[model samples]
Target: MGWPYLGETLQLYSQDPNIFFSAKQKRYGEIFKTHILGYPCVMLTSPEATRFVLVSHAQLFKPSYPKSKEKMIGPHALFFHQGNYHSQLRKLVQSSLNLNSLHKLIPDMEAIAISALDSWAGREVINTFHEMKKLSFDVGILSVFGLLDESHRENLKENYCIVDKGYNSFPTNIPGTTYHRALLARKRLKQIMSEIIYEREEKKIMEKDLLGYFLNFKDEKGRVLSKDQISDNIIGVLFAAQDTTASVLTWILKYLHNDQKLLEAVTAEQKAIYEANEGGRRPLTWAQTRNMPLTYRVILESLRMASVISFTFREAVVDVEYNGYLIPKGWKVMPLFRNIHHNPEFFSDPLDFDPSRFEVAPKPNTFMPFGNGAHACPGNELAKLEILVLIHHLVTKFRWEVVGSQSGIEYGPFPVPQHGLPARFWKESNHHYRH
Candidate 1:
């Protein structure tokens, strides 16, 4: 804690968050207390502590966020709740994103990737993370609605972008403010979702997508979900999918671009698949996507390196004790995923960009790129599939170069390369892969 009331809020926000958290862990050990954003928080860095808060004793903690964020993303979003509601919604979301269902989206996902890459080829330098966000948004829509009509898709994207821009802004609700505009846009999104829901209901059309799962669900009490509930969960999933995936994808590109040898190896792995698919004439199979061990390791390393979701907020539901320490009720508990990922005790040469280290599985609870326990990202598989499909097309068909001297990270609430790794891409020549 720092000055009165303000506490350490300024210190936490004034410097790089990683530096702030890492310094605290260095000075005070794995579990330390601090005050920020007007709340006393216990930041946990050790794997055991993280597991206690997120898994083993999760019942004693509840997910917490600022009131403004809850309102913007929808109060009924699944992550914002626990107990029966969270469990039931998680089941539906998990079922929708299950392997069997995601496998079906491969062809469509590939097309989205190709289209995105094609749009950027030979163009002026573009922000890779920003472009990846659009790609991720399209994939999110595909997973949620399963081929929604073009007009409705465009409408949702437009309004969602406005809401996203305002999400992390100052929470002032005055007219003309980003947060205020986000509120208005969120209303428009609800209206658009209402229309889509009405159409689905009127047609009694139920496909095996997230929306389908939500629409068809009935709890043990025979209670059906309301329109607001359906819309909120759908928006929640989209919000979850967009930035995190894009940021990781952006980091993957930067990492690959910076290491030519690694880039060549990943390119070779993808080229074998490219040739197996008859030089892009055939679609990528689920098996092909699964077998890219090298590429998969690169992805794992990127996720660990970036740790986009550095930490998560949970509040003690009741006074809790762990290993002789007392956590008073109402105190916020944060599991520092980034600190654990970068910890030397857990990962040797933690600062190096080494994908080979993943050859052996990580120790229990040490590698939680998506998080841990009941609240781990349900769409993680889908997110990975989207990344694989895009990388398959990108490496096999396009060559890109980072366009600036960018060696720093920026946190737009998620760590992404400075200026989103401004870069240019060109279609790879057919003969480029020939010996």
Candidate 2:
């Protein structure tokens, strides 16, 4: 069987996974050929092949895909940079998202999560996705950007969505187009950031937030980053930090709703922790989250089953030989994460939603929710903290039920519930109850 043209097939495959699974099985087997906007692309499904593309031979590949920049929040952001430029920018961004800094941000994260929970305590129905999205946005603004004003927070949330829609639109800046609107949105966001930057510079506010760190960051030449550079980097961090966390948390809640036994186990774990910290003197700490081994396993499992980023594309910067296949330069190589995650050889009953798959022996390099190699997501640790904290609060404070009795979820570019995930929330009447 040979490859097919990039038209209805690609669109259909992206929108509908059953069709994609069938195509992968019948047409291309494990590896397939396709095109994105008329560019040659090879989609590798096998774990070994994906590992080769993403990790082993990563240097030969670069994330230079045409839509990479546009699909991200803006051009020249961290996602699009290459080589030394990428390395340098990644270092500066890493300062704020590093382990120590992420630990410091946990107190702020808990406050945001708790505030959201308190607001929805007596509500009959709520959208967990929307709640989590707002929680994440608030955290990003407060912890990352050091912006705590209510009006500013609301404005950033609105502007961020517009920018996200713009990035997902086709890369065109024509009037009345999504991209055009995104440009306007970007300009608004930039203007806001410019004012913030100016104030920080003028007032010499030496706070500990991400913006503060960036303001003080200096290159090897002892030069501060330009205003445009600061704006681009800030946009990159905000985009990377916000939506990806929301998607993962949303999926975790969905999986917990579907599996009653798992949900019971997770809820029990939360109760144990809450009871242990009886005094309100200490909130759920980062160390405590780290101690929740079951929670971590569940998160990893959800990431494998409901991968937010379905496939990752890297352009072959040079001809490479892998497992006797000659991958020529300039070919767009896609690491088909869905296939690798569900491969029976690496994961037993790969289709089943089982967190125990990660309990015994780890699944090698096959499970890469944060991707692998040099260009891996820099905010991976922060994302994990966001998930753990949100889950902790939800499982401990309230109970939820999925709107439908569907067995599985639908796949968007990112996996989302086919029916909007509607759930009722209530305070746990019996706080000391055991599972």
For candidate 2, write residues 1-435 as lDDT tens digits.
124555444564455564565466566587777666556778888777877877787788888656635444556676776777678788876877777777878788888888888887788677766776777778777666764667666777788888777775677757998877877888888788887778778988887777877788777788887777777877888877776777788888888887888888988787788888882247877679889888899999988887787788788999988777778899989887777777777888887999988888656677888877778888888788888887888887776677655444554346666544667777776665554
lDDT value, candidate 1, whole model: 0.93
Candidate 2 lDDT for residue 79: 73
Q: Candidate 1 deviates by what RMSD?
A: 1.0
* Top candidate when judged by lDDT against the true structure: 1
* lDDT tens readout by residue for model 1, 126-227: 999999999999999999999999999999999999999999998987999999999999999999999998899899897999999998999999999998
Query: Would you list the clashing residue pairs of candidate 1?
Result: none
Q: Candidate 1: lDDT of 185?
A: 99
